[model samples]
Target: MIREIQSQHILQALELGEIESGQGLNQEHGLGRPGDTRWGSHYKTVSNVTALYATIVKVLEKIGSNKIYKDDRVKAITVMSTFESFEFVFMIHLMSEIFGITDKLCQALQKGDQDIVNAMTYVKLTKEGLQQMRDHGWEDFLHLVVCFCVKHDVEVPTMDDMYVPRGRSRRFFAKVSNLHRFRVEMFISVIDLQLQELNSRFDEENTELLICVSCLNPINSFAAFDMQKLLRLAELYPKEFPTNDMTMTALRHELQFYINDVRQDARFGDLKGIHELSMMLVETNKHTTYNLVYLLIRLALILPVATASVERVFSSMTYVKNKLRNSMGDQLLNDNLVTFLERDLFSRVSDDDVLERFQSMKTRRMLL
Candidate 1:
């Protein structure tokens, strides 16, 4: 059914543009293909399935009842048995709600301009929201599941009724109420595990590090720069910034003076990142004045940028050097990769400027 819907949508899109094909509706909002590295894609697939549940159910019913195709009828019956139940619907909604919170965090972190401080905040908020859902959203979610089951003509199990074990070796298993089995054990436990994983990964140390690193941002007239946070950032590296009382006190004073001097200068006012700040300081020959502070800033800047840029380079390489270009020479490949990676910077260069630089690279026989 999903394949049919997607194929029909694609054909319509090819015949008419997406908007016109769906009569101004979301024509391209068909099924999604989820992959291992893409949590957002999985979430989108689940959401689209939920959105098209009625159509899916109708298709499944038609296939299950069709005596003409025995294989299809059997497969459709199995699918209906699995997906057309209250438990499945409940799980679908539950997972969608949970993934919705995480989806935002996933997107925010992927952005190049993403702020560490904001990302930490998002993590905190997601954890809190998951906790709230576990505590307060139980009854409401159950009510929603019940309503959906009623609408679809599926049996809504009595919450207070005893649930029996469905196995061959049912040797007098202890009884559990449906309410406790589904609501407490399944629902609450699932949410608790997710919350635990998030909390463990995004602990206090990580949060503090993000907040400290964010202090170096020089945007809006260096508004994010905090002397205390900068000191904390320095403290994170004891080998670089000594923890001895005398050395720490003098380092604090140096940091204060450095920030004050930079804030007063008009040239530093427009700087956006640690990279730009470092470059400007080098241009003015002031890196030696605040050597320790400069070293810290350089470390903070390079690690994150280098890691992200390297990943991007490798990702783009697959597209740039496919199987067809397997025999591409290393030097030419390197040059092309550099140009592609630095396209933003290259875009600002004029054709004449590029020609001049290329001509100046060597004593060419003739100039263009």
Candidate 2:
């Protein structure tokens, strides 16, 4: 119904010269459903709702008045009432802004060739953006919400007026103004919570590990290589580098020679990431010469990609084990999951090859 209303509205606007021919809507412009794994979807959902607010309201009104089912009418009326409120409008706008800040980081993390360095950079930018919003964005954001309410015919409560709880008596509860509730409790508090969550998730240890790992990035002719951070990264892995002063000194010396040789070699100049660097090191037979540095690079590549692969495996389980295969045994389920998850590799195997393998698994009754 929302899509139908949006289509009609767009067509009417185009016909009346209010919009251009090139301004037609696409799938992305329509309302989006939020997904658990995709943070960008949440941003799109809130943005589309705000953009099509009037159209959504119209749809709800039609359902409430003309629907034959009592439950449908009740649901539509309830949703319409909630949508036509100043509080809801404020929240939608607030979330839209917050999600917009983190959308880039979300996308960076989701990419197949994930760049930990760039991802960490984006995380920093997101935190900074949220902090700036919390500190200086209140007055402007509130004004925007107020203008939206006034334009939509929703009642805009006076900020200085005393806020009264819907079901509580003023005598029993503490008195607070609308400004305190919305600005302090809602806006500032929400941004603070988001910042806190980011800090907690990407704490000092994790951030330092990623930053040190990024020192191995081969982009820009090894511009990100920092001897101290790379040494610190090696120190984090005590078993690999050992606890003695001699091992640390040897690693530092190897790092110096490794960076020099790679920076001067033209073959390593165009490498994009640490993975490619690892491959190139082996190809050039340099891994044996600087085995310690190679070991460090291997360690750096393990965590992020391995973690993403594990997550992908878990996510694939849902598709591989559906209701029809609910009673599948452990071994059968594991085999099926392997076949499904590694379908790209399996795609190269011919049907004849699979048949031959299956035939070879056990003796058949007739071999004619």
Candidate 3:
């Protein structure tokens, strides 16, 4: 009987395989524990499986050979049967490739320094990547899968063969070859669906409004700024400006004043982001001077930043308020979330500052 401690032998095999595979300094890269909260983690999991395929198979084969541990043997056999298949290999590679595109967009969107222009660019690039994959990716992908199977001594099924649907009890099975089904139904159809969904979700829904707001962005020396767009942005806030010919004329002149003043202003010259631009306006006491334009930039900046912030809050909430702590009170949970979510901000805060705030919260029985 293989001792429980002998599982280290399997881990050793994985380590050797990682070195052999030239995984660089990350030779310690083991099976990835994909996260439920992080959607991009699925790509990492699939990639790790692909990289450690041979090692995993070797470990599973050894475990399956163990007679005394029947449960371990059965599990090994089940895993081997499931994993060592043409469809499994194909799906792994396919999903990994597709996820590579999505993972980039996901990371970019989650960044604290994310720019709307940059995010929009990423969205466009992701769509194009999916489209390119749909059009020309099948041949290269098939070659990769075939090569992996050959290297691992896994049986490569004949693509042209008639694909018999498993289980005789099934009714109305579609007549299709493995090649056609894999290429058309699985690959092309899935990519098409992804592309369609991306377009629907990130399409030109608020593109015009976004473009108008982007003019106020302090990025790249405000290269994309358009006076026309800025005027359009001001026209958007009807509540701030009355809808009369006299008010409209005055508003246009005020916008012209803002553009000229900001362009020549040294304080505005060094601004980096929307947040900085908003804060600088207040620091230099210019917010009230151009109250309507300030309001516009504030609105534009808040929507995207706030959306990203809320998403981060929810992501943290998943970890802070999981099923184990399901009975936690709302106020307690909120306080915990605030600290956890704002840890980056808190890290820069001095210990003395924290102690002072703690002392101010309430007079303690003893010194805090």
Q: Name the candidate that leads on lDDT.
A: 2
lDDT of 3 by residue, 117-195 (tens): 7777788899999999999888998999899989888778789997765334325658788899789989999899999
lDDT score, candidate 3, position 315 = 82
Steric collisions counted per model: 0, 0, 0
Quote the RMSD, in angstroms, for model 3.
Answer: 4.4
Better of 1 and 3 by lDDT: 1
What would the per-residue lDDT of candidate 2 be over residues 68-187, giving only the tens digit for each residue? 766799999889888997888999999999998889988887886777788889999999999999999988888888888887888888889988754357897568898898888899
Better of 2 and 3 by lDDT: 2
lDDT of 1 by residue, 154-201 (tens): 788888998754333546755688888788878999999999898897
RMSD of each: 5.8, 2.9, 4.4
Error of 3 at 40 (Å): 2.8
Candidate 1, clashing residue pairs?
none
**Model 3 ranges off by over 4 Å:** 1-26, 166-172, 232-252, 318-332, 348-368
What is residue 193's positional error in candidate 2, in angstroms? Answer: 0.7
- CA lDDT of each candidate? 0.80, 0.87, 0.79
